[model samples]
Target: MGIVGYFLPMLICAAIPVQSLSRNAETALCQTQEMQGLCALSGKWRNQLQSEITITCKKGTIQGLYDSTVGNGAYDLVGKYLQVNETDYIVGWSVAYKNQHRDARSTASWTGVFYAAEDIIKTQWIRAAFKNPEDYWSTFTTNQDTFSRVQSHPCLHNNRN
Candidate 1:
């Protein structure tokens, strides 16, 4: 076989494996626990304080609005999936606080582990710092927060007829 004929077949065979590998990678990402967690967390969540957070996840990033009686804010969070045996992600968020006694902003770094079975994003704020020096006392060295999925149609009463 001439050089052209031999190289053509070799390139075709190489391209086939590359395409298969690409598909496999996509499949793996689709089924990854991290992705599943992102999907599950894309909805609304509520904390014990009766505060509500509406989160939207897109391309490994999260944006949310936190509404509470004390303060309301918007946050932009970025996350990276970790290669732990379980589904783990590290995320950081910058919150712009509004309508509060003190107009201030804060940034927090969190380590989150997604519990697929419970459909909850268990997060720990590893570090938090405020933009204003006066708010330094409020800085959180370590704090644990759980974001539970908010049930849709919470006001609807389920009555069996």
Candidate 2:
């Protein structure tokens, strides 16, 4: 009976859900308007200067950067795009951090979508270009290279070079 008592607690724990409960909470939390945009991007992102970017979708302002400093930053879902004030050093584009070899590589651009009510802005660059091949290409390549590269792939595959 004493052994059964110890096993009973273990059995009860096994019966109760811990992972599921956490997942349910996470899903519910992420579904919130502020977090909705970041549901796919809530992670540790690092920049070339080894700057750490922690994106959380809670009740707070998601600040944008100018010269790596928050400047003229706005988190609003205005119209179809999430408009953040253009940063001096950032060139009005969001940089996606790629974690590789214990170092994060800053990608050319990221797709931004802001939620005003939630005071959250989400940015990510999963693929090369979201739209407008020419526009996305120029962000990463110079005029000469952009023209040449567009000639071959024409899809901006190697535009990141």
Per-prediction TM-score to the true structure, in the order listed: 0.49, 0.23
> Per-residue lDDT for 106-156 in model 2, tens only?
334444443334333344433232336566653343111000000111111
Candidate RMSDs in Å, in order, are 15.8, 19.9
The models' CA-based lDDT, in order, is 0.48, 0.29
Give the range of the ten consecutive residues with the poorest summed lDDT in model 2. Answer: 144-153
User: TM-score: which candidate is best?
Assistant: 1
Give the lowest summed-lDDT range of ten residues in model 1: 152-161
lDDT of 1 by residue, 1-161 (tens): 67455334222222232234355554453353333333334446676666665554434555555555455443333344442335444444444453445454545455677565676667776545554678767676687777777742111111100
Q: How many residue pairs clash in each candidate?
A: 0, 0
Model 1 Cα RMSD, 1 decimal: 15.8
Taking all chains together, the TM-score of candidate 1 against the true structure is 0.49
- Residue runs of model 2 more than 4 Å from their true location after superposition: 1-21, 39-42, 56-161
lDDT of 2: 0.29
